[model samples]
Target chain A: MSSEIDIKYVADLARLDLSAEQAEKLQQELGRVVEYIAELGEVDVTGVEPTAHAAQLTNVWRQDEAKSSFPREVMLANAPGIVHGDLIKVPRVLPSEEE
Target chain B: MDLKKSTIHALSRNLKDGVFSSEELCREYLKNIDNRDSEIGAFLEIDRENMLNAAKAADIRRQNGQALGDFDGIPIAVKDNICVRGERCSCASKLLEPVKSPYDATAVELLKKQGFIPFGRLNMDEFAMGSSCENSAFKQTKNPLDTSRVPGGSSGGSAACIAADFAPAALGSDTGGSIRQPAAFCGVVGVKPTYGRVSRYGLVAFASSLDQIGPLCNDAEDAGIILDAISGFDPHDSTTLPDPAGGYADAARKGAASGSLTGLKFGLPKEYFSGGLSDAVAKVMDETIAKIKALGGEIVEVSLPHTKYAVAVYYIIATAEASANLARFDGIRYGSRQEANGLVDTYYKSRGAGFGDEVKRRILLGTYVLSSGYYDAYYLRAQRVRTLISRDFEEAFKQCDLLLTPVTPQVAFKFNEKSDSLQMYLSDIFTIALNLSGHCGISIPAGIDEATKMPVAAQLMAPALGEKVMLEAAAAFMK
Candidate 1:
C-alpha cells in the first residue's frame, strides 16, 4: 500500500505540487495501480535481459561539421523570459548566504 | 461531388486534372470545418490563411506543370503533438501553451516536400497520457459517428477529423493504443509502423520507446499513401530504420491488384477472443474473419500467453519514461510559467498548474516506480516482462505471417461513462502489447454494432519491419 507520505514524497521527486486532497486521492489510486502491476512478480524472468528500447540501434555517426540551426531569434521567440533578445533568463540559483 | 468522402488518391487525380484548383479544395475544407467543427470539436486550431496561401502555391505549381506528386495540393490535418514550423505544437497541454515550433517534424517536412499543405492542429489527450479525448486540456473531441460518445484517444482528434470529413486524413502518435483505439472508434483506418520505421524528430517525447507516429485515414490504401510519404530514415532521429527498398504504398497497390491473399497466413490469438469482448464486437470479428478466409487467407489459432500482463506492463514502463521525459518542462523554458520566490516553488507551481490530473497521477506513479527502493521491483521487472512479451510475438510469428485481433473490447463508449482510470486503462488491453513487442499494427473498420450503431474494428499486427506484409494484408481485408 502506498501511504500518503509516500505519495507526497513521489510528488516532490516529480517536481509537482499536490494539494492534500489531491495527494490523498492519488495515494489510493496509484496504490491500486501498483498493486495491480505486482502481478508481474509471479513471472519467472531470472535470465531475461531488460529492454530499454525495442529497436536495435547503435550510435550513428555523422560528419563532424557545423550545420545551420534554428535562428537565434526564432529559438528565443518562445522563451518565457529573455535577456539581450537572445539569451533565456532564469531565476537566480545561488543563495545570498553562499555568496 | 462531396470531396469529404473522396480518398487522397481520388482527390489527387482531381487536382492533377484541374477539376478544381487546390485553393478551391482548401477553401471547401475550411468551409466544411467552419460548418461542422462546432459540434465535433476535432481541430484545436486552424490556420485558415496559411492553408489558403499554401493551397494557392500548390495551384500555381500545378499551372506551371511542376506539381510535386499525386498527393500534392491535398490538405491533411495534423495532431497538435507533431511540430509544424512556425505553428504551435502544444500536445494539448497547458505547459506548452505558449510554445510555437520553430521547425517542422521530419514527417511534416516530408509531407510539405510532396506539396501536401497541413490544414489544422488537432486536439489530443494532454501529453498523450489518457485513453479518451476528455483528458485534453483544451476541449473534449466527440465521436463523429455518435456525438454523445467519446472519440478514443490520445489521437482522438486526429481520428475524429477524418471521420467528420474535416480533413481527408491526419497524422497521430500512438503510445500504447492512442492511434488504433481512436481509429477503431471513429471507423477509420489507423496504422502504427514498426518502432523506428518512422522518424520521431520534432515529436514531443512521451514514452520514447513505445511512441510512434502513424496515419489515420478513410481506408487502408490512403493510410499506405500517408505512411509512404512520412516514413524513411532521418539523420535527426537515430532510432529510425534505414529506408526500405519498396515503399508501403507500392506494396498496398500491388496487394490490391493481386485480388487475392491465397498464400497469406493470419494468426488469431485465442486470448483476444476468449474474454472481455462484447458480443457485438465478437460478431464483427467473426464476420471479418470469414471475409478474410473468403479472400483466400488462412487463419490459425495462436497464443500470446503474456497478453494478459500488457496493460500492467505498459503503465509502468510508459509512466516511468514519461516522468523522466516530462521533467524538461520547467517554467524557465517556453511554456506557461508561474512566478514564485524560489526555484523549487517555480517548478512545483508551474507543473501543478500546467498539468492535468491524469498527467500528474502518471508522473507520480512513474516517480514512485523508479525511485530508490522500488526500481528493481517495479521498473526493472516491467522491462524484463516487456522482453518476454516481445518474445511471445516472435514465437507467434513463427507460426503465421501476421496476427489478427480486436482493436478494443467494444465500440466507442459514452462520455463520462468510464470514470474509473483503471477501466479507462483496460480499454487498450488488446492494442498495448504491440508497442511493447516493437511491432507494427493497423486498425481497419470491421463493422458497426447493431445496438449502438457505433463502429467496431479489427487489428492486424506484424513483426518488426513487416509493414509491407501487414499493409498488404490490410489492403486485402479492406478490399
Candidate 2:
C-alpha cells in the first residue's frame, strides 16, 4: 500500500552499504518499481490459496548414514577470508568497551 | 568444418562414420572460438587443455569400441551459473569471480556420463538478474547476428555461444525467460522444461522455484538430445519430478518425419498479441500462424485475463527468493571479500562492493517487500496472483494442447537502449507467465524481422510435464 522505500533501513537489513548519493538515486528508481507493482492490489485475492510453487514439494528421504564427502583441503582451498588451518576466520564479533 | 553451418545430429553421424575423430571436431570448435569469439565475447574461460584432453579421451573410447552413445564426442558450452568441477562458475559476478566449483551440476554430470564434453563457462547477467547481458561485470557479450544489439540475458552468452557455433549446444538456466528470450534474439532453439522436469542440485540459485535448466541448440531435436540426457528425478534436488527421462530424442525425430499437425489444436492467447509487440514481430507471427494452418494445424482463440499482472508478480517472488539465496556470499565464504573493522561492517562492505547496481536494486526491493508491515501486501499477495496466473493457463490449456505466442515483444534491441530498470523488466512480459505456471515452453526461430533484419522467434507452450508434445510441436515447425 506504500510506495516509499526506506533505502537505508532496507539496505541495513540486506547487509549492503550504500552512500547517500546511491540511496537517493535508488529512492526514485525503486519508488517507480514499487508503484508499478502496486497494480497487483487491483486483483481480488480473497480465498485464494497462495501457490508457493506450481508443483507439490515432498520431503526427500534418505538412510541415516554418513557418506564420503569432499576432502577438507579441497573445501578449504576456496575460502576467501582468513582461515586458521582448516577453518575460515572472520572479524571479531564482539566490540571492546572503549569510549 | 564449419561449426556455424552444423547440427548435433549431422556431426554425430560424421563422427560415427569416421569422417573425423572427436579430437578433430574439438579442434574445429576451438579454432572457431579462437577466431570468432573475441568479437562475440561469449565465453568467460575456454580451458583449452581440459577440453582437448576430454575430446581426445572420447576419441580413444570410440576407437576402442567403448563409445557411450551417438553423442559421445559432442561438446556443450555451460552457463557460468551451472557448476562444472574445477571450473569457475562465476555467474558473471565479481563476488564469485575467483571461485572454482568443486562439483558439477546435476545437468552437467548427466551430460558427462554420456561421453559429452562440457567446456567453456559462458557469460550471463550477474546472478542471472538483468534482461540485457550488459549487467555482466566481466565483459559485454554482443549479439552474434548484430554487433550493435544485445543478445538478451541472464542466459545471453549461452544463446549467443550456440548461435555463433562456439559449441554444438549449450546449457542455460531460465528464471523468467533468461534462456528463451536470449535464444530468440540469437536466432536458435531454446527450451525451458516443466519446473520439476530437470534437477537443480548444483545450479546457483537465483529464484529457486522459477529456475529451470534447458538447452540452446541449432534445432529442436538437439534440444531433445540434451533434455533426454539431463532430465528425470535426482535425490540431490528434492523438487525434481518423479518420472523417467528418455524418449525425447526419438519423439522429436518422429514429429519431424511425420511432418503434419492435422489433429493438433494450438491456442492463440488474445492477451499475448494485444500490446507492445513490434509491428515487425507481429507480421512474423501472422506469417507463422499462416504457415501452421497450412500445415494442417487447428488454431483457436483463448484468453488469459491475468497476463497483465505476470511481470509485477514475478519480480516480487523472484527478488524475495534471490535476496535470501545470495545472502551466503559473505566475506568468510569462498568468494571475494571486502573485510572491514567489525563483523557487521564486513558483511555490508563486502556485499556492497561485490554486487552490481542492478543486483543491489533487487536485493533492496526484496528486503523491503519482506520487511515488517509489507509481507502480506507484496510477497504474499503476489503469490496469490501467481495462483491466478496458473489458473489462467489451466483454463486456456483446456481448449488447446499447446499455446503459440511471441517469445519477446520486440527483436533484439541496441545495447543500453532500455536504461530504465522498469522498462527492462517489462521486456519479458509474455515469457514470464509461463515460469510462474511451471509449464514447458520453447522458442524457435521464425525468420529475420524486416525492421531489425535480426532474428525473431515464436514460443510454444505445453502443459506441465508436457515436454514430449511440446518438443514434437517445435520439431514439426522447424521441419
Candidate 3:
C-alpha cells in the first residue's frame, strides 16, 4: 500500500485548501498516520459484518403531520449571509460569462 | 462551608436546607472562576446575568414551594460542542467561533427541566478531535493539579473545572476517551454512557456513532444524578434505547452503601496491563484491583484479542464520520466564513481559514479513506474490524460482570509532551475501545502518581446499556 496520497485532491474533495507548505507538511504527516493505521491489514476480517454506526435501529419515523419547529428566522440567523430576509445567501456556483 | 470541597449530594441538601441560597452557591462558583480560572483556563464563556438570574429563580421557586428537584439550582457547566440554545457552541474552533446553537440539546433540556442551570461554555479540543486541549483554537486548558501539565481532552475543560471546584458537575461528550481520559487526568469522576443511552439531538456531531454525552463530577453518585437527568428515550433520537430510564442515582448509592461486590466478577483485560502503563499507573491499578478484591469481588483475567487494533479502527471510523459530520461547516451556513469568488472557493477558504491543523488533518484522512477506490480498503475494513473489536467486549462480558483498566497509559504530562499526533491518538487506547463497543465506562481517581505526582484513574466498563452495573462497581471502587 502506498502512503503517497494526492492530499490536494483529498483536500479539494473535503472542501478544504492548503498552501504549498501546509500541503507538504500534511503529505508527510498524513503519510505517517496512514502508515500507522495500516496495522489493520494484519487483522483478517473474513465474513465479518461492517457497522456504519452504533445505531441498531433501521429508520425512525414520526407522524407525517406538521408540528411547531424553530422559527425560520432563528434557523437562518446563523447563516453567514442572507439574501431575502429569510433565505441563506452564498457565492454563485457558475463562473462569469466573460471568463 | 468550603465550597471547593463540596459534593453534589451535600450541595443539594444544603440548598434544600437553606445552608446556602442557590444565589450564594452561584456567587461562590463565580468567585472561584474569577480567582482560579486565569490559571486553569477552563471556561470559555459565561452568561453571568443569566446564570445569576437562574439561580435567583431557583431560590424564588424554592420559596414558592415549586423547587424543580434535588439538582435544581445546581449549576452544570457545558462542553462547548453541545448546544445550549442561546450560548455560543464553538467546539473551541475558530471556524465555529461565532456560531450559537438555536436550541438546547435534549440532554441540556432535561437538565434544565431538573432546574440544573446551564452555566457556561467549557473549552475542548477543536471539534473534540484531539487528546490534548492544546488543539483548542481558543486557549490551552492546563491541569489544575499541576499547572505545567495538561488536562486531558477534548473534555479537558469539563474535567479541569470539576477538579478545580469551579463547577460541581459538568456535561461532556465522549467519542474517543474525551471524557474519561480527562476525568482521570484531573482526578475526578467521568462517565461515558452506552452509545444512544443519551439523546444526541443537538450535540455538535463529532463521530456520530461513537459519541455519547455523559457527566464529569466529584463522585459516582453525582455522576449517577447527572446521568439520570440526561439519559432517556427520546422521540427525536431514534438510536436511544426504548427502555425506561431514571433510577441511576440509587444504583450508585446502593453500590457504594452496600460496600459488597460479593458475587460480582470483575474482569481485568490482560491486554490493558501489558507494555503501556507507567509504573505509577501500574501501582495504582494494582491497588485498585486489591481494593475490589477486598470488597469481596472475584477477579477474572479476560482477553480482548483485538485490543491492539482499537486505535486504528477508531481513527478510521471516527475520522470518516467526522469528515462527513464536519462537512456541514461549509462557509455558506453558520460559523465563521471566508468568502471567495465561487461557492466552492468560499468553502475551501472558510474551512482552510477556520479549522485548526489537527482538525484539517483528520478531515483529509477521513476524506482519503472514504474516497472512491480506497473506501473498501480503509473505511469498510475498519468497520469490519470494528465489529471484531465490539465482539471482543461482548465475549469478555460473558465471562465477567464488568471490566477494569487504566484510563490512560500514564498520568497527565506537560503541555506539548505529546506533540506527535499518532502518539496522542495512541494514548487513548484504553478508553477508545469502550466507545467502539457501545459499552458504558467510568474513570474514577485511583491515586496520584508518585512520580508524575499527577492523578491516576481506574476505568470500569460494562457492556452496552450497562451503566447500572458499571456505576455500581465504580461506586464500590471509589469507596
Identify the runs in model 2 with alpha carbons over 4 angstroms from their true place. Answer: A97-99
CA displacement after TM-score superposition, residue B466 of candidate 1 (Å)? 1.3
Ranking by lDDT: 2, 3, 1
Best by lDDT: 2
Sort by DockQ, best first.
2, 3, 1
Model 3 DockQ vs. reference: 0.81
lDDT of 3 by residue, B1-479 (tens): 58774678999999999899898999999999999999999999899999999999999999898999987899889999999988889999989898888999999999999999988999999999888799999998999999999999999999999999898999999999999999999999999998889999988999999999999999999999998989988988888988777788899999889888889999999999988789999999999888888999999999999999999999999999999999998877788889789888998999999999999999999999999999988999999999998889989999999898999999998888998898889999999988888889999999988877788999989988888888887787777
Candidate 1 — which residues are off by over 4 angstroms? A1-5, A96-99, B243-246
Instruction: Judge the docking of candidate 3 as incorrect, acceptable, medium or high.
Output: high
lDDT at residue B374 of model 1 (Cα atoms)? 86
Q: What is the Cα-based lDDT of residue B385 in candidate 2?
A: 98
lDDT of 1 at B58: 88
lDDT by residue for model 3 over A1-99, one digit each (tens)? 887899989998998889999999999999999998888999899999997767577767777997999889888888888987788898889998988
